[model samples]
Target chain A: MSVLPLVALVGNPNAGKSALFNALTGARQKLGNYPGVTVERKAGRLALADGRPVELVDLPGTYSLNAASPDEQVTRDVVMGRQAGERRPDALVIVVDASNLDNHLRFALELIALGLPTIVALNMVDLATRDGLELDAAVLARELGVPVIATVAVRKRGLDHLREELGGLLDSAAPEAKTLPPERDFDAVRGEARRIARAAVVRETPSRRLTAAVDRVALHPVFGLLLLLGLLFVMFQAVYAWSEAPIAMIEGLAEAAATAARDALPDGMLRSFLVDGVINGVGSVVVFLPQILILFFFILMLEATGYMVRAAFLMDGIMAKVGLSGRAFIPLLSSFACAIPGIMATRTIADPKDRLTTILIAPLMTCSARLPVYAVIIGAFIPARDVLPGVGLQGFVLFCLYVAGIIGAMLVALILRMTVTKGASGGFLMEMPKYQWPRPQDILLGLWQRAVIFLKRAGTIIFTSTVILWVLLSYPKPPEGSAVSQVDYSIAGRIAGGLNVILEPIGFNRDISLALIPAMAAREVAVSALATVYSIDAGDDEALLERSLGDRLKDQWPLPTALAFLAWFIFAPQCISTIAVTRRETNGWKWPMFMLGYLFVLAYVAAGLTFWTATALGLS
Target chain B: MRLTELPLRQPAFVDLIDWSVLSPSEGQRLREFGLCEGASVEALHHGGLWGKGPIACKVGRMTIAMRRNHAAAVTVRTGPDAAP
Candidate 1:
């Protein structure tokens, strides 16, 4: 058997490192956490030209080897053989964005200085050509004392040649390819790189005149801010515009499935469980997947296009006012999709206090999981009447809810910044990369991954939770000749009813109280829980369940109480995954517990205030 | 001083080398881009549209942005001022 060689991939952000990894490894890859940290590590094996395998480790992206962040530190540790019990790869595939080679080479130069057997993988060559830039690969390789390979990783253009070259290098195992001169040889290498770079790399045109011209207008205080807001408005509108058909289709299919199950099963516990408990509970949340996917698609596009950096830059002043850096904006923006990623992104912020502040406020961003509950309640009660001449009242209310989250996060960040620090605040500094049109392939890749994750969560957490909630609300039939509904005798109802006294302050009745239990699994599960509870007798009819909710709230519960319930759902920080992630990220129960405590206080206070104000106004 | 104090369109030599070796902050940015101490680099242009324009250099790989304030720090050493 031939000896297998090892290859490592390294790059700065947006350098197509992962694309190259995918091209090399195909579908064979595994994701694992880097020892103790939550930073993901991906590794795979690629067969060489000689049929021997080459192990590939795709290192986390970092700007430089200075290693300020944990992700960067991992890269530095692994490359330097400082990671205990980890074997350093034989050769480093230094991926550089061909369009932004100059900015990227600073890191590349550092990697070259590390004296590893290194090959420069100049990625995005096609994009570079489109920009009218050219690189002399041979001359560049001569300059750096390493082979240079131009690759369009997205297209799988250079993999064959790359494999061939690497296989030959490994087969030869040339002593020169395997060793560095000395321990302190970096200064000489750096000097040599400068001399060679000056000779090899040349600019046909020495200007970013186009970028500057665009930025001048876009970064203007007055117009830039307006443009940013306009961009966001368009994104939200697209979410609504594009997702409507898909959502309706899914909803229709679910209703149909429920109907079919009802007809197929005999009128008994089996029929009730299948139709009401299982189908209704899971179906309610599953139908909202389209809107969630649409929202994530736009988010991923904006991120890839580098427009998010501009948004962060524009928001820097506002963030600074609240004692946070522009860096917090990245995580906060990510939090708009989900708090887990938003918390994970806090690693970018250097200051501990600022990182913590960002993490604490992340859940307040109103993730997509809450959208189902919001949509259901708003659709049912919130008047469709427009306040403006042409604007939608429903959309306006949704906008206000989003605004409330932003304001709440800022308020908390401000309070924490003042209290935690003795008037010393963390400063935000960041690189503002030139904006480019988002690559369609990259955007699609990101969107596909996000959609898969949402589907996976829906399949596992929502599916299983719905079934469990269904069983809890279905089994142990009420006694013979019982006047009350079967659900009234179910375990879920009894538990929720028992808790209603304490929840009475927020105007939660037995049904609402019971819904909150499954909601801990996911905020959206509350809708399914409600559906399950209502459909216990209605069987598989979704339309009937929807009407039942409307009727139950309108007849049994006052408008003020419903409004209070809405307020509670909006402000209550539920979701076990979120709290558990917080615990993991913060590395303790302290912050998660603190988060739950304060959010509950806020939820109750908000609900109570809404109830009182609505009652005072005599709305119901 | 800061790069903001340097006069625009001036040809100045950076005195310091190995800028990437500095703190991963803005200070390191100046050094890494060959704007180090005693190295000759010129800011060829300023803002055309954006409030801050991309400064093209006669020196390194990356073009660093020069806000109006920092563009004044680089002292020119051309013609009579050129050190032999």
Candidate 2:
């Protein structure tokens, strides 16, 4: 009869709130966007001890309700009952790091002043004890006039006790809990919070801090940069090496399925659609899933181990020189997996100019979708021998593609900062979380989420684009005994023919042009489009030798053209989802249009230059 | 001395923070993180390629990363009177 009681978890940035949320909800969580805003709304179902199912929402971490960042603003608004789409929380769980009580308590004290029914979760007590901290939770509860629970969210310690506390708090049509902490100025409140924190701590032993020890090596100017680069190189190499067998297995399965479809269906359009469009088309995109998953695995691990912020710390000076802050580095690194989320992540950067510059340059970071395009091209043209002792030529080429994107993004950011988005950059401020062993369940959950997104793309967007491409290439059958190939007479070919006038100068053949249009929907669709076109073309000329898509490409395209195609993807800005997200993030089409124009010009010139240089070098 | 000028690895007490030198939001953020007067502080490390970039300061039990320019507004004292 009543709406599910909404309980929100709130905390500072590094207070282990996410781990606690995962522990409480397990896999029953649902993620969506808060209406009218791009911030994530994460909610899950939690069954209280009284057999009542309540909604557990995880609010973004913030230091205070002062609304410093977009994330913090959302957290403040949701708790204050003014957020665009969220209802005011029925109760609040204020999570604070056990070791960092003095700083975290400032916010907790402020939240207590909001007069909401509240509980303090003394999270990460295990880490605190490891750091020689001994705290009395009873003192904290007594001082704040609310219940306090010590929890190690990652280890699932004290969770049942936490649940019992939650049940009791909800059971009382508890007389509206009055504001316990008195109103005071920011400084006074913080000072009182310091007093409370001191009272709660029974003893503070000076133990060898694991964070400082790790920071000595990981943040050393020379050694730290080297470590970051080395980790990246190894990750790229592993992406290519570890996923090889799985990729081969997927390709074999696709071939067998296509063969079965051809035999099961009659000789008509149904057979062609199943085999050429669904099988080979979407199958080409699906084959790259292993590489994407491997890439995400390394990223998630870097994030879990608390090394990502250190990477930003190391990059600060260089980023400053470009009129940006080190905070931009995290989003840029994430753009390697996808531009949509990377653009969304920019909300944490406070300055408008800096956030805009970061968004404009994000698409240049060779996204995982671009990986399939580069992999096929390099496999067909480049030699696979060891270029150096441990560097294979193919992997080196892949790494070069990634570097090209990074270099291009940096240059673009510099130019944009000096021109369209020019302004004084905002200062960087953040917490450096302590180093700890990454939990297996957290990493697996992250990987599982990415895998689901990848597969859904393969099923929906890739499938539809492939089917449409098949139809466009299959119709308008060429006349009997005619010299014109079936493609030349089809609708898609004529469309490519019109566009070839502009693209031919860059060494892009008609086939590449045909693949280009469909790829605008999503970057990975280009691979499927090419596979479909080639598969359909193969069926037309029965006398042609049967070959894999790579073999077909190698036989047809010149080395210069292949290299030019690879160069184009480094700066290509055609992903529809990326553009849509940019629109939502910037709240206008102006920046996205500018992004499209600049990237298009850059891609054309880069492809043309690669074509000319490779041809000039006698590699034609 | 301003916290930025405080010698590395030396423990000091925050004396006076010129909040006027910082933007409202930046000042509020610093206050929220407990980098106020009478708090114990130490400059841990300087990060950047050239080691002239942002300074990592220990304010209470947390390590806070802040740009050099922002750290220049907070005055600190390192004598016996600096003890909390």
Candidate 3:
């Protein structure tokens, strides 16, 4: 057995580094957190033509080795072999955007000074050529003192040459410490890069007219904001419209699977667990796959097409007014999918205060986890009328719920900025990369990764929680002839009964209170927990048990209570994983505890207000 | 005049970068993006209704957006060769 050599993929942001990594090591990637930090650690395995394997780590994209931001610090640490628990990489694969060599080559020059065995993958060569620039690879190689291979990462061009070069270097001893130009100052390195570029790169004609033409409209103050909002509206609308058929298919499959299990197995604990715990619990979360995938698809597309930066540029004015950098927009937008990644993405925010404020408000963005709770509540309570000619009233309400989260986040950020995190606003210096057509493969890969992550949670955390809830609801035989449901005597029932004292004022019944306990672990689990609890409470009423969870909730709870539940979820301190990630990212229990406290108070007050207002209006 | 005072669409040569107005890291970043002395920059757009938001400037072949406060630190002079 031999240790696989570690090869790190390093490049500037949006330089097609990840794309090249994916091209070289498809489906062999593992994503985790680096040692103690929440910064994402993505590593993959690449095999050479001769079947020898090497580990490839996709380091966080950074502009330079100045170590200004956490992400950049991690990149610097890994390249220098200073990151704890990680050995120095055997080789370095510097992925550079050929179209943007003038700007990218400076970083390339800085990396070369590390005196490591390095190969430059001149990625996006096709785009560079399309832009009418002629790049002499051999000349660049000679000028940089390293092998340069032109690559179109998206199209898989020049990857074989890249693999061959990497393979040949795998067996070579570490390069001896070569005396290189002093790198203490960036000016010297940047000057050297300019010299190298002038000697190697030839320009035929200037390109980027198409990009500039598109930007003219996309960056128009009036039209640009409208276009951005329209794009977001369409994305949310598509999440609802496109996910309908797939959600229905999944629901149908879950029902059929439950039915099959019920008919095949004898009436026993095993059968009950199979249908109620496994099928109903995991099934509820799994149905959300389509919506999550749709959200990520749009996000990944916006990112790949280079429009996200322009969006930040457009929103900077409004965002800055709320005391957040425009760069905060990307992380906050990512929170719409999940807060963990959104919080992690805040590393790009160079200012610590701005990054902290972004993290504090990220959970208010209404992640996809909350979609299940909102979907069930809205489906049952909100009537399916056409608000517009084609839009369902349900989706419109769902959109409003999402908007409420965004507005809440902004308010919180404003409050924090004016008080605790108050300071000079962070600088919003960010590069607006040239626009390109998003590659389908990259989109597919991104969506695939999201789906896998969601399903893995369903299979593990949701699965275990559901089984535990089932046991809690099923155990402890009722006293003989006791005039109550079996669940009334169970442990979970007793706990909910006690909790109802605090919950009743907010229009939550004992059943809703029971669901709230597990909902803390993950918001979507509340729906499954309610379903399992209600099904058991309906014992001996086969038809009632078979009724859809939404129908049952509508029958059991008043409209005011349902509305209150929706309001509760809007501010709920749910999703323990989010809190844990926050703790890790902030490197303290203080912020997470504070987050939990404020969110709880907000949820209680909002739910109470909603319930009382609806009751006062005679809706109850 | 400060880079922030530069008219939109007019190119100027950066004269001096005053590090006093910006934090150390921000000054380093601005320099890394080619906003150092002698670099040619063209103000492309000013954000917000009152033009108090981030200013988008073209540096080399890249366009970067920075707050007006940070842009105020860099003094520039309009030049014929620097015109876009």
Identify the leading candidate in terms of lDDT.
2
Q: What is the TM-score of each candidate against the true structure?
A: 0.86, 0.97, 0.96
Candidate 1 lDDT over A35-133, as tens digits, reads 777677888889987787888999988876767788888888887767653577788889987766655666787788777778889888876675557
lDDT of 3 by residue, A416-486 (tens): 99988989777888988878887688789888889888888888888888889999999886988998777
Clashing pairs in 3: none
Q: Candidate 3's error at B42, in angstroms?
A: 2.0
Query: Candidate 1 regions off by >4 Å?
Result: A1-6, A22-32, A43-55, A81-87, A99-103, A113-115, A126-133, A154-160, A174-192, A385-390, A421-423, A537-557, B1-35, B38-84
Chain A of model 1, TM-score against the native? Answer: 0.90
Of candidate 2 chain A, the 10-residue stretch with the lowest lDDT total is A174-183
> Which one is best on DockQ?
2
Instruction: Write the candidate numbers in order of decreasing TM-score.
Output: 2, 3, 1
Model 3 regions lying over 4 Å from their true place: A177-182, B81-84
Strongest candidate by TM-score: 2
Give the C-alpha miss distance for residue B48 in model 1, angstroms.
19
**Better lDDT candidate (1, 3):** 3
| Residue-by-residue lDDT tens digits, candidate 1, B1-84 | 334434545655553333332334545445444454455565543332343433334444343443333344454355345442
Per-residue lDDT value at A322 in model 3? 94
How good is the docking of model 1, as DockQ?
0.16
